[model samples]
Target: MFWDLLVLVFYFIIVFYFGFHFAKTNQKEEDFYLAKKEIHWFFLLLSLVATETSSLTFLSIPSLSFKGDYRFLEIALGYLIGRTIVALYLLPSYFSGNTISVYEYVGNRFGKSPQKTLSLVFTVSRLLGDGIRLYVSSLPIAFLLERMGLNLSPEILGMIALTILSIVTIIYSVVGGFRAIVFTDVLQWFIYIFGGIFALGLLVDKLDISIWEGIKNLQTSQKLNLFVFDYLPSGDNSYFILFALIGGAFISIGSHGTDLMLVQRVIATKNLASGQKILIGSGIVVLVQFILFLCIGSLLYLFYSGQTMAPDKVFSQFIVAEVPSPLLGILVAAILASAMSTLSSTINSLSLTWARDWGMDRWFSPRTLSLFFGLTLFISSLVPYFLIQTWEKGILEMGLTIFSYTLGPSIAVFFLAKGKAELPVSGLVFSVFFLTSILSTVAIGLGFQISFTLLIPIGFGIQIFLVQISRLAFKKN
Candidate 1:
């Protein structure tokens, strides 16, 4: 336990050093938000992957595979397809513009009101979604402390872990700016990957099974099954392959193309070509990373002989009960790395949107705004502590569902701007209301059933239909 704590302390020290090391370089808004557009494609690729996938990927994805099958990979394939579309259609507009905020394109195309409105949507959605991620990241740490015989409530333990995570992440993000976040993300990407590989190795060794034997075991149990061609409207694991593919593609486009959290990294690249490489390459990397963790879960399921456990708790439980000392600390650090990477990116992007899109720069420096949003997000992270206990779905699914509510309207607005459609504030409000209602189970209350996968495209279609009606009305008037 002592050695494990020592390793954890050492890891924290290294991360802090990097943060302070880059603190000297942040002299302007660009440096603070976009890394001065100086980031390399390789580092940006790593940062992109690390930022988009939070602790949800690190901790929850394995649990997802353990409880279910690898059919989720179909969504990843959809991600690749979606990113390819963004690379071809979206990157050209983002690259053509010189502004740091991607929503600046919205303002240039439409008006200031929509830009600010969309920025608010991004901020609120990220706060809710990544806030849950920050909380989820601390779960394993809380569990680790409990296993070490700490007598505390889960609430207290979660608070302790979250406070540490927020303080450490905010200090670097505020001081070192975007450069620090990206560089640390590069290091963290490798650490968590190594941790996943190490955990799989330990699981195989302890199970006294060869890799080939484990594969056979998984195959015989049908845990290796990766595709479901049937269409089901609602059931456990009721994902239809066709809907999954289309939904996955639209979600990816919305997330990577429209969200500033990712587009910021893309535009920071050296050129259009580099941006394209980073965007598409990150999708591919995400696919491989998902496969790796899912394999780990499969191996773990074989090791445990399919004993039922809470899906989210399975991987963390293994780490605490089964992993040896120093390596346990390393794995914990890896989890922290994943959580911090995403949080730091969220805070930075949120601050950037505040300063650039919302015009907060008129009142405060970007640095001050960065710190402010960091603290705001820290508070928001606590919200999930109350909500998570009652959640019935896997953490990964819950996070995805929360974000899906906003993705459709957000992406639809982008298409509106791109088409030069003139939409009023009421039009935007109606779009949000319509999308949120239909995409949610609330639509069932209205006697309609909408699959989650179809939400984004449907929302996008709705926006287009409304815009056309509004245009025709203006013409008649």
Candidate 2:
């Protein structure tokens, strides 16, 4: 335990030092937010992958496997189909606009009222979503290590881990900006992928299960089904596979192609070609990463010999159960690396959006930005009750649920080009209210899987219908 903690402490120190060291080079808004448009496509690609794979997914994937099999891959299939659509359609829009905040383009197309409204919604939703993700990643380590005779409650341990992460992230984000986040993500990406491979090797060798045998075991257990047609009986609208294909494509196009966190990387590119390349390469890399984690999840079932383990905690459990203590420590560091890479990327982007879109520059100075960034992260780390529920229930459902609820209204404002709609301020304010209410009701009440994937197209329908109706009525007068 002492040795393990020692290695982790050293790792934290190294990350902190590196993060601060890079900050010395950041000086302007472009430097702080977009890495001054100097980031290499390769680094941006890794950062994109890192940002997309949250700690929630890291822990949730194995838990998902334990539930039935590869039903979780349904989500990945959706993501892949979604990314291809995004690369072709959404990528060109971002490349042509060349904006800092993706929301700005929406504003440019429609108006400011809609732009700020949508940006605020995204920031709020992402903070909640990523906050849950951070807690999910940190909690297992806290729990597992505490059982091994460590001294800390799960929450405190969770917070401490988050604090360490925030400090390292702040150091780079405050100083070096986007470049630092992307470059560090390059290093983290290697560690996480290598660590995932190492964990797989440990499971296969330690459990006496060859890769083929592991697959065969899962196949026999009926955990390998990738398609499901069952839904509430008598319900004719039960088309999850279709939703996964169609809804997922639009959701991906909107979130990855239009969301600020992602577009910031693409816009940071030296040129439009490199920007497109980063999206394409990152899409491929993310798909491979998901496959690797999914395989690890399947292998974990064999490692445990069918004994019931906490599904969400199962991935970390395999590390603690199968790997030797020393290597387990390394893997733990790698897991933390996975989580930190994401947390850091988010903090950096959040700061950029807050400063640029919200006009933090008009209200406050740089020192205030640093303090506000830290405060926002601290506040965000506290909202993980959803993590407990998601863990107890299932990962895929929780993620899809979130996407379904938030994506519709966000997409409505964007594709309809309603950013600058005439405002007594009511139009912008009402749009935010409309989207949030619908998303909340759908998420909490309707409870359909992949709701946003289905609803986004519907949102477009709603937008166009409203526009035509309003125009016709005006002409009638």
Candidate 3:
């Protein structure tokens, strides 16, 4: 335990160093928010992956494969397809002018009202979705401390964990700005990826199983199954391959193309080519990372045959109970690294959106606004620790599902703007209401049980259809 604490402390010191080091370079608002458009493709690529992957990816994804199969890879493939389309269609527009926030494009195409409205939506959605992510990130820490004989309740431990994460993230993000976030993200990405690979190797060694033998066993058990061609509207989240593919594509579009958190990183790159590389390259890295963790989960199943646990808790439990001391600490730090990477990005992005879109920067410095949003996210992160017990789904799915509620309307608004149409504020409101209403009525009120996978595409279609109808109605008037 002492050794583990030491390693964790060392990691944070390095993160703080980078944060302050980068802060020395901040000369203006653009430098602070966009890194002065000086980030290279490689670092931006890694930052994109790190930003997209929270502790959910680090901990929950392995649990997913441990409890189920590898069918989620289909979604990763869909991510690749979606990213390609974004590179071809979306990246050019973001780079076409001196755009700071991607919502600036909306203002140019629609109006200031829509741009600010969309920014507000992005801020709210990010708060809710990443709040769940922050909670999920605390689980491993809570489990670890509990195993070390801490006498606290899970809720107490979770809150403590979240507080620590928030403080570290806020300090760096406020001081270091975007450059600090991106560069540190690159470092965190390597640490967690190495941790995943090391854990798998350790598991394989402990089980006395050869790689091929484990693969053979997993294959025989159908645990390694990668594709599902069925279309059951009410089936499990992993079974509907077609919907998963389409849904994955739409989610990627909403997340990578429309979300300011991600688009900020893309536009920070030197040129259109660099931005394209960041988008497409991140998809590939994410796919590979997902496969690596899924394989680790499969190996874990072989190691713990006949044991039953909650899918989300399985990986963390193994780390606490099974792994040896210092290595255990390293893995825990890796989890912290993953969580902090996403949290820092969220804080920075939320601050940028608030300042840039709402004109808050004129009243307050960007650093001050960053601290403000960081605190807001920290408070929001605590909400989930109390509420997550009532949720029936895994953290990853729940977080993604929450984003679906707003991402569809967001993407539709962007697409509408691309067509140079003036979208009314009422039309934007109606789009969100209509899509969310249909989603709830069909899936909850009527109990037809549509898969969460289909929500984004369905929502996007609804928004587009509504916008077209509004356009036609305006023409007739």
Candidate 4:
């Protein structure tokens, strides 16, 4: 136990070393976020990959394959399409202004009222989505603590886990700023990817099955099924190929094109060409990443001999029971790497969004910006304590589903801001925003039968449709 923890401590030590070492001192807001400095495109590509990938990708992708198949890649396919579209359209707006918050582009195009409105919606959605991610990362940590004979309730374990993860993430983020976040991001990305490969190799040695034999077994069990060609929404978050492709595309566009945390890295690149490269490249990188982790899930299913368990629990239990010490600590560190990279990004992004969008920067220094959001994030991370078990979906799905509510409307508005037509804004902004929120409430909260994948596309469509109608209404009047 001691040796395992030591490995984790050493990893964090390196993270801190790089964080403060590269962190800009006497920094203004531009230096703190993504202004004035030139980061290489490769680092920007990896930073984009690391920030959005989160614990949900690390743990949930494998869990998806363990229970189902490679159908999740259908979403990846949509991601590629979505990103290509963003590179073509939305990114021009991102670069057109010296926009601090990406929403500033909206303020430039529409009005400040519209800008702050969308930013507020993003904050609520981001906190809730990232809160679930914090919970997912804690699953393994809670499992590890239990293995070490910590006789605590799951909620208490969650709190302990949240505290440990948030503190380390907050300090470097607050002290080092975005530069530190990106540098550590490159490091964390390598660590977690190695961790995935390590687990895959371990499974290979243990299974002791021929590649041909394993492939045959996978075929027989339908575990290699990659496409779901259904026509209608299954109402259960099931991915029909079309639903997956379309919904995934919209989700990617909304997330990568509109969300500040994901898009900022792309915008910080050296030029428009570099921005497009990283944005599109990240989608491809993430698709490959999904394949790697999903394959791990397949191997795990074989290792466990097809026993049914909760998707989230399957991998966590395996890490606790089978993984040896020091190695065990390293694996835990890998999970922390995924979780912390994102939490750090969240605190910084939240700080940027709040300070820039809502006029908070006038009253708050850059460090104070990080400090406030970091504390808010720490408290938010514990929200899933008792409620986690009540979730019907895996952590990854839940995280995406929650964000789709607002992400859909957000991307829709971005395009609306870009269009040639002048739309009526007096009530249109709140109209689409509240309508999407209420629809999400009714669908998921009341257990309606819409594919979670379709939430973004559906919401985006609804908002765009309404804005057009409002535009026509003004012309008629």
C-alpha lDDT values of all predictions: 0.82, 0.67, 0.82, 0.81
The lDDT of model 1 is: 0.82
lDDT tens readout by residue for model 1, 240-324 = 7887888899999999999999888899988999999998999999999999999888877887784877777788889988988
What is the C-alpha lDDT profile of model 2 across 1-477, one tens digit per residue?
667777677777767666677676666666767767877788888888877777666666766666656655565666667666666666667667657888777766656666677777667766666665665566656754675776866677777666666666666556556666787777777877888899877777777756787778788998787776666454543235775566656666667765777777777887877877877777678767877887788777777775877777788766766666666667777777777777666676676667766777687654357556656865666665435765644543454355555565565555555233432324565465546545554654455533444666655455445555665766688
What are the models' TM-scores? 0.93, 0.86, 0.93, 0.93
Off by over 4 Å in 3: 233-238, 385-400, 421-447
Worst 10-residue lDDT window, candidate 1 = 437-446
Task: Please provide, for model 3 over 1-477, each residue's C-alpha lDDT reduced to its tens digit, 9 standing for 90 to 100.
Answer: 878777878898999999999988888899999988888889999999988888878887888789889998989998998899889997788888888999888877765777887787778778877877887788777877787789989889888888888888899999999999999999999999989999988888889778898789888888988889765555565447787788888889989999999988999988999999889989999999999999888888888888777887788888888878878888998898888888889888888887888888889888999899899888877765555555524544555566766676677777776775466446356546445544543454126455666767766777777667766887788
Model 4 gets an lDDT of: 0.81
In angstroms, the error of model 4 at 9 is 0.5
Clashing pairs in model 4, backbone N/Cα/C closer than 3 A = 235-449
Tens-digit lDDT track of model 4 for 1-477: 888878988997988887688565536898888745488988989988999888777877899999888999999999999999999998987887787789888877777777787787778777778877787787787777777788888778778878888878888898888888898999999999999999988888889787789889988999999888756533454488877888889889988999989888888876788999998999999999999999999988888884777886677777788889989998899899998989888888888988888888899987898888888877766765645555525544555666767777777788878887665756446445546653654475436656678677767776777777767877899
Clashing pairs in 3: none
TM accuracy, model 3: 0.93
Model 2 stretches astray by more than 4 angstroms: 144-148, 228-239, 365-367, 383-400, 418-464
RMSD after Cα superposition, model 4? 2.6
